[model samples]
Target: MCIIFLTSLLLSPARTHNLEEIISDCGTKLQTFSIVQMNYDYMFVYVNGEKMGLLEDGRLALYQRFPVGSVLYDPCELPPREVPILTDAAEYGVTACKLIPYGHYEAYIPEPTTGDLHPMTGENVCVYVTNLPPNTTAEMLGRYFEAFDMVAEADVFTAPSGECTGRGWVVFQDPSKLLMVPPVLEFFPRLFIYTSLSDKIPTRTTLQLSSVPEILVPGTDIASFAEPALNHNRSGNHRRMNGKASGNFLKISNAANAGVINASAYYFVALIRRDEVEKSVEEGVFWTNPANRRAFYATLERGPVIIIFLLQEYPVIFGYARLLPDGNADKNGFSACTVEWMKHHVFLKEQDMRNIPSVPISKMGDGVPLKPEIGESICQLAEQHPSHSTILERLGQSSPNNGRHVGRGAGVVISGNGNLGGFNSVGGGGLVHSVGDRGTLRSGIGITSLPQPLGARPATRGGHIMNNRIPQRRRPYNDNSNTYVGYGGGGGSVPPRKL
Candidate 1:
């Protein structure tokens, strides 16, 4: 019975060997060791300690022929794998280590705090940062934290004067990476970083309408500058001519054709605040209130309308836009709408806004309440379609010639009897003339004189052949020459050919 009791005691975990005794046995081979106190009576053991893969009741297991070095730990002769520090506090009871400021605002290790070795809560890991550079912005702080790990959000507090207050908070998506904060602070050495396990990270306020610059608002036309020297003519006849002119001799005008102009379309100006413009420029998004949208829809009822932007003191004409029956509203309750340009329109937030020029339009008479005119329609149409002159100019481009000849038909010919005729399909190129016949030319290869008889002689002015039967030399054909000669059959002298 006593032998059985001794055997039972030998196998019991409570009677296991001491850690110091195990280290002594290991001697110089014992690089490092750690004890994880599981309960008052039992503990886990590790050599060359690591956070994982530890052996429980290690001394009892070793006595039962458990292999040495089978429960592996990092073999490198370094500090503890979890917290790399060697101190008396670590030997005592402290498991986690933190570096705090010492007497001269320098770095020093304090007694380990009592808590879970890794007390990571499943909340957003945030760190409050102080003593930041005066010029640091929220975007800059966010970018700085992004180098360490994925940051959820960052915000830097600012003074009333728009200067940074040297205070900010950064929230990380990974709670495990929060341990990197102390090392990062130590690396910087100039800043103070406090880690927190709360999700109350600071956020900036959204841009508001009042924050927009006043310059973006449309302005009223007041009396100041003199009237323009030339005014646009409304009459279609003289529309091209800017000033009053009588004759069409010069015909110098800017008149547009009637086909393209949409006479029924109305015109209106929409005002976009500076903040909205900036947002649109940056994110391609712009929003309007229901009242303004309704007004825009009303103008569209007449026909397609021209939308002008009242930018600062000038009236810059933007492109046109049509209203949709239903549109989605953003979280801020601003409905989504599209503005059309020459090519296409894109969704405000989901697409890109086209870059267009800001051309200023002239105001009409004072207190005239800017109304639609034929000139506006003409201008809009001109923008939509190319000018008639431009079409003609494109058609007038010179074509290349590779020495190929083109002709409608055989050319007209004047006969020797003062009659006009055309080349007919004779054996030779003899022009057929009729006194009162409607003349038309027939297509032929080339012009040739009628084949003369083999022994034909030259005729004299007296209707008699010369005594010598001399063969007359035919004239060489000159395509470009305007002169034409005809031979008289009888005694009638061939009338001189006239152009």
Candidate 2:
């Protein structure tokens, strides 16, 4: 019973030899000694101050025999806690040795923090760092530096939240702390990894910043001196360049017969085509509202009726027509008002035009009331075909002035010899009444010969084009019994009597 007890006592871990003695006895095998620390299920190894790798499974079995050179860390050196053990001999296995004094295993003892100098000041800043590896605390930073020199202020922004994202800035009262920065980066969770050196260190120049400047005080009422002359010049230039006056062409006037009353000019006649002229005439008669037809005819100076078709809507059809009272010069009449194409083709959004308001017929005098003539039809047409109502309304609203648009001219009309192409006159005149597009002169006949206009230089090229919008106008000729009809307008001069 005594022998068994002695054997048991000898095998007990408490009876193990001292660390220094065990390390000395191992001799050459002691050089291979290493420490393994438990990190959850896996254990990490440290040898010669370098971390090796994780221990594989089946390497953690307890109570295994080892060879003479085998190595294992003493549990006494570690904090009182559960320590994982290796079992698989062929893998993690090592020879067992009696414990030795920690001092004898000099390589295993952590070296004092050395070679760490303030990166900026090159000062010995080692004593400024404390509680380094396992439980590094913010208070340690303050205490450690306090031993070296006076610290005006010490602020340790501990990552109280969690592990930092691997970046931090520490400002010391002495600025010497900048020297001790690790070449390797430190990590903390949930923060961005800083790469640029400027981001880590604050500069003296940046610390001296200034506030923004104040707003200036309001001055005079600059709007009072607004000049209308400038506005007029600008508006006139816009009218000349951007508006309807920009589109100009020559036209043909009456060339129907030898002695027919033809008076349209030559330059005007040479531009337009005979087919367009014919279509305009036909649509003018056919599409004229019956109610306004007679009054329109009576207002003509010498012709039966002034057939004006709104060419804006293609397939030029007669639009809502109104009579021109002999003495009515005021813009109270629709003919006196000019059409202003919007800068953008936006839908009309005015209030009065929105509702189905009543318009009196008596307001029209002898001609049909402009509103009654097209209002109901327009509304009904819009209801059925919303896509085309505005176009129709714009067409109905258009009217011809002498030869120009009511407010905008630079356009002309010809009727006497409306010959745009037919060789009736030296310049051009024909048998149709036609008005040209803006910046042009027109007459209904056929382009006979193009004559240079007054103050107008001859075009470098020939072939006078009649309509500005439809740049192309070439059609096969038919008989004059069927008058060629063309409908076009611009604000300018009047054409001859008839086509």
Candidate 3:
């Protein structure tokens, strides 16, 4: 429940993040409001009176927005509880944000009322930081430094010309915390992570996902991006010379890069085949490793949406499904649990996953660990599907099919090229949702193109994948070394392609 005091707000030009989702879920049901604007802006966050670090435009999530020329913040105007720093992302849950950069005031943490002494170590520690980006707030510096130790307060310096010098001092609670910092401070440039390890992957100054997806070829509007952008970490195998990538022909798009994934939500990966997906989604269960029950179930406690890296062709990311955390092991030592498959499946190919370094593609079975950014990007890109980001279980509520989904759910007429609406599903339910000449919403499982519906037969409760006798192309089984022999067309298996 977001508490937005819109009565005193002066309507003007601005933008919002995840506002439609918020309003659709709970906002509209409680109060009547409209968008402040839909443009680029800045965002800040505070947690328990402590402000966090600044990343490039981390303003992708917001409850309510402020006008362009309004007060950025006024802590004195309201009680302390009224303000929360929640502008970072939705996955972190609670947040309080200052709207725009107008009439800028302190959205920083308050100075300690106690004496200048550590609560425990009884020592004062302050580290000077330089080469900071423009308008680097003390709160952001404090948040960044807290990675090494307990930050008490942060102070920034201003130049003689009254402009910020991009230099600041981080005050830590304990002097011992300095030991945790890198010994070679001189090597840290603009805070880039240039370690002593030779095999380390190069990184960009900004540690956030690039808002814009990279294009591979010139004058080609193909559905792809030249990933490994600043925020993205493509595979180490792909080398960059003068910003021209030699390998890893990756693809991403402006639409895919749009803020979609809930950074606060957890994401897991399941390396399963496409044929088994419908059965699992129908049965509301997915299986995982048996040895590390804690590793799989403990992480799912955060409600991670399991990404299905379908073992078809080049092992592309086929679907996105959410699993209930309460999973139990079977008699033979395998784990399984109920699942809620996202209406639209994720279809990122090998190049896409390799380019997306945050996606642990090599991880086997159902234990692919994904960072918040990767999960967020995957979720955002899933919205581009024809399903319009509908959930299977929720959509199936409108029509009953004896405890089964009704052909990828009905579609609504949404603006755009109308390229992503449901087609005549395999078992048509007489509920049509076609808009314009948009393509079919099928996952392209057996056939090359669309116009064919997926088989939606009821699934039986069991641990093993049901043998439906569906003639699926053989899945390439990769070994621990990432080297595998591809099946040949002439019946003779091709030798393992040397990596």
Candidate 4:
């Protein structure tokens, strides 16, 4: 009676199901690997060169056993395992294999093959593709269909408009037999289906050579369409189809004067000696550290700030008003704020100088005739400056409300009575000259000088001119003075002078 009870228990469906489950859980799916060893019934299987373990009949089963030198039948084949004494295959996959990755072994999916007429050769064979965007091009489509042996040429289309529609067509000489052509690109997330037979369009889609789709029809004919010129107009403003950024971003034309640096996009930063406000070199670079930022703000609290760069060449000068949050540059700063301030204030200032006459250097009313070429020269000077950071700092100081000026000025001279003028030039405009020493004279008489009239010769030294003192030539005119003259020509040389 005891023996009979044991037999009945082994035959129970639950016991059999449990045994199948153990066998399935012992191994993995797609066992394209080797069985290195076995621990009694549990077998150690190697797949894709990786080793793993599997079980059978509770813990008393081999995963899969194979005779040495036995060849794998399929690309997806696994190392053969010992067949269980049981005859049921369904129980192995359905019950036992459920616990394994991928459940049971499956075949490798190969690129599809197409079998149809070659439009050029009229040959009946499988079609293949080359040079594709991973899986995007039409050749890939044909390669995918070749597996079924019924696909013809795949002709893909691209709209010049770059629209999202999958408006292109794929032609098959005969697709009735070969179904399931892999999808080309799509209209949305899903693949587009080509179900029409009689409506195969003969439009010639331009081939990328690499991505070009094949059209396998009776004739090897192709057509071409002119792609529309790229519409750079992004604002939907057709009126501005060719209109460009006129102020800041436009590339300055050089077809006229070569070697001239246009200063349309440049800015200035001056480190003028605060005391010697007129001369630029006296103003050293604003060295910023945590400590300097504090000093800057402290000075700001007292009164308006002045930043300056004594530049020689750059024509257009731009300024950026950075509303720096206290400690912004000193702490973990977001560069986006810096960039935004640059785009708005500096860029707009450049535009103002370009369009509004009042915003230019002439606005100083030193009577200097502002020349467009001088602006270009200033731009060249800024570009030639030693460091980009130094230039940016100078640019920041020149921002509106900073109360800075960049042109040459009567910086401190030992002989304070030195005359200075004609610092700038514009074509066809009269020279702008600066008046000599004002306020009280060194003689302390407080006598004002005769204001020299325009186009008149410079006044003689110490000569009385119409009740005003003719100031003495305290120092001789030299190239270093603001009065240095330039003749615009190919040589582009400054005129000779002596101290």
How well does candidate 3 match the true structure in TM-score terms? 0.29
Q: What lDDT tens digits, residue by residue, belong to model 3 across residues 198-298?
A: 12232212222212222111122324543434221121123322343212222334443333322224444445544556666667665543422344454
Model 2: lDDT of residue 9: 49
lDDT for every model?
0.33, 0.25, 0.36, 0.28
Lowest summed lDDT over 10 consecutive residues: which window, candidate 2? 204-213
lDDT of 3 at 311: 36
Candidate 3 stretches greater than 4 Å from native = 1-263, 290-293, 302-313, 331-333, 344-346, 350-366, 386-499
Worst window of 10 by summed lDDT in candidate 1: 206-215
Worst 10 residues of 3 by lDDT: 421-430
Residue 107 deviation, candidate 3, in Å?
A: 33
Could you tell me which residue pairs clash in candidate 1? 240-253, 240-254, 240-255, 241-253
Could you tell me the lDDT of residue 409 within candidate 1?
A: 17
Candidate 1 per-residue lDDT, tens place, 1-499, comes to 4455445545668656665654454543323322332321233333211111212322122111212112211223254233332235323322223211110111111212222132232233467777766666654554455434444345667787777687777665344455555523421323444434443443342111001011111122222222112211121111111232111111111222221233234444444443354444344334544444544554455346444333222222222333333344553355444554221111111011122211112221111112233223323332443222111222232223311121111212222222111111111111222111223533342333331221223234445554234555566433434433444333344445545
TM-score of each: 0.20, 0.15, 0.29, 0.17
For model 4, what is the C-alpha lDDT against the true structure?
A: 0.28
Q: What tens-digit string does per-residue lDDT give for candidate 2 at 1-499?
A: 4455445545668746665644454553334432222222343333222233332431322112222222333343545222333345564442122222121110111112222212122212122222233233332222223222222222222355543222222333333333334433222122112211221222211110001011111211112111111010111121111121111111111111222221110011111122333342233212222223322433242221222122321212222222232342242242331111111112222222334332211111122112111232222222232223233344244344322221122222332223222212111111122222233333333433322112222323345543433456564333442333342232243433654
In candidate 4, what are the lDDT values of residues 375-455, reduced to their tens digit?
A: 333333333333232333343443422322223332111122333221111211222222211112223322223222123
Compare candidates 1 and 4 on TM-score and give the better one: 1
What's the residue-level lDDT of 274 in candidate 2?
A: 20
